[model samples]
Target: MAELDKECLFCKIIQGTVPSYTVFENDDVKAFLDLSQVNPGHTLMVPKKHIINLLDYTPEDARRYLQYLPAIANAIKEFDTNITGMNITTNNGASANQVVMHSHVHFIPRFEGDGLKLATRNNAEKYTSADYEKIATKIKEQF
Candidate 1:
């Protein structure tokens, strides 16, 4: 848990000031149907706290929210048996398509022929083992 961003849409939703079609809620997590239904049962789950973006979450905050993600996804799947698969995603920053500053996870339920396209560029073959190691080492340095 952290400070509250009063102007943030999710914070307002959590406070019960802004109406949302809630699907799941506990002490610290709240999930609801996404306004933009990417699929039959598109949902968005967010921490009740006002942390901004994935990088802002404390380890405990991340743990609490992640523990419920599967349950929410499974519930959505069960609600719509047509849900054959799902795309669980969290965009970190604006460059990664994070329109809202608040940290949230999108649970996009997929059905047969649900023509939803996620931006997935296949550039695996373009990078060599050396290139991979270089990126990995750079990332590992932070730890």
Candidate 2:
């Protein structure tokens, strides 16, 4: 087994200590209902391993963690036919509202006017094509 952070909330949930409405689970991942159901079928999928965030993921860790996304998302959608769309998202750091240090993906099922709002303020117009290329080049160099 991967080393578990016993202090981590996700680790306790995965280890069957903290009760959760588990929707799906396997050797590598577990999916369950989010306590605050922003919309019906709202769920969270997390790696069984005690990973902190995306920034800390090794390539192998990322591969094993992400391999379950498709099936988990499909399961959430299939669980509720009224779901008009879905948002699969994760926060990587404290500034991004990641209260839980352990990495998790939120599967938010959308219904028409379900009172959930997920919009980013438009800031694209501030950057020119040259600025975009410069930014892309800087980031792409890391690969």
Candidate 3:
């Protein structure tokens, strides 16, 4: 493992150099209210260790980080009666809009009237069965 980045914002929060409204914390993970609340109960969960992104996680790191997500999400939901749904997401690289270098999972509480929407375009081209098989075969080969 690498040494903790003293300048990292998440690291600062974990070290108590910066203040945070921490909702949960354990030896391996921490959950806190997001500064930019997309909804009433938006929270951010992060590994206690400094990992750049999802691709950097070891299997143990991945397991420790993810195991608490369900309980944390449920706690957020129970905290507010207005929450109707939730969106949990983690962006990897800058191309995927990851602003922070440290990997973190976002727990966004959703309400029916909330303006937030995930936009997607159906720009995919049609493929033949053979093309699908070829694509699957290529991916399977890597595994």
Candidate 4:
């Protein structure tokens, strides 16, 4: 297990120092209802170990954490027949709107006409195939 941050809220929850409406828990991960529900069945999944964000996750840790999400999300879907889809999101940093330092995945159940939309304004700039290739090469170089 990674060393827990004594003051991290998620760490407190994992330690049972704070109360959470737990939906599921296993050796390496925990899922619970979010206090501020984006929808009625919104949930958050976090690794049992203290990982600050997605970039901090090792492949093994990420695999362990992600393996449980599908099952948990499916169960949430069963809670409402009206659930038409779901959104899985993880904000990596403050610039990405990550309020908590500890890593978490949001499982938001969606229904038709829920009035929720994930969108971004269009940019007039367009890239050519060479631009795409250059970007891909740059990313691949890091790997």
Candidate 5:
């Protein structure tokens, strides 16, 4: 947990002010159905404490949240038996299209050609193995 904004919607949910159709909850994490489902079993996972973005999270918080992610994804798969793939994503600032101020991960179950189209224009470059190694090394430095 870090400094929190009491006005954040997810914080309100954590405080039991706003209602949620929660699928899972632990001492520090909450997983619930997304109000606007991209697919039948769309779920949102959040820390009970407020965090604004992935980059803002502490390593300990990340480790704790990650421990629950697989379980949540497995539950979604079990709920929708026919799911073939899944995408776990988190958005950051408004420019990145994050609608909520609270940090959350979206679990989107994917079917073959589910007609989902993501931004491709900025993803034009094909990186080499060396490039990936460099990027990975840089991120590891921060950790």
Candidate 6:
């Protein structure tokens, strides 16, 4: 837990400052329906204690947060059995299109490219296994 902005939408939801279609709640985590759904039963999970992004979360918080994934996935599956698969995304920075400043995970069910599009860059730079290992090491070191 850390200092939080009472005005943040997510913070307000966590505090019961604002209304939400919440499906789950506990001492450390909260899950609720997304206002904008990519698919029916789309949901967002957040830590009860405010954290700005992945960079602001601790390992313990990350572990606890992840513990709720199976339940969320099951709910999505139950709601849309036709879903062939799913995607979990969390954006950290503005360039990544993270509209909300608060940290949260999006659970979106995918149905045969129903809502997915990505452009390929044939000549894009590539990283080797060793290069990726170095980057991973640096990221872990920052935490």
**Most lDDT-accurate candidate:** 4
Q: Give the Cα-based TM-score of candidate 3 against the true structure.
A: 0.91
Pairs with backbone N, CA or C atoms under 3 Å apart (clashes), candidate 4: none
Better of 3 and 4 by lDDT: 4
Candidate 6's displacement at residue 76, Å, is 1.2
TM-score of each: 0.93, 0.94, 0.91, 0.93, 0.81, 0.79
Q: Tell me the lDDT of model 4 at 97.
A: 93
Kindly indicate the candidate among 3 and 6 with the higher lDDT.
3
lDDT per residue as tens, model 5, 30-71: 898899999888899988777888878889988877689999
lDDT per residue for candidate 2 within 38-106, as digits (tens), equals: 888889988988889888989998899899889888888887788888999999999999999999999
Give lDDT per model, in order. 0.88, 0.90, 0.89, 0.91, 0.85, 0.82
Worst-scoring 10-residue span by lDDT in model 6: 116-125
Two-way TM-score contest, 2 vs 5, winner: 2
lDDT of 4 by residue, 54-137 (tens): 989999987888898889989999999999999999999999999989999999999999999987686536877888899899
Order of the predicted models by lDDT, top scorer first: 4, 2, 3, 1, 5, 6
Better of 3 and 4 by TM-score: 4
Q: How many residue pairs clash in all the candidates, one count each?
A: 0, 0, 0, 0, 0, 0
lDDT score for candidate 5 against the true structure: 0.85
Candidate 2, residue 6: CA error in Å? 1.1
In candidate 4, stretches whose alpha carbon ends up further than 4 angstroms from where it belongs are none
Off by over 4 Å in 6: 1-3, 118-143
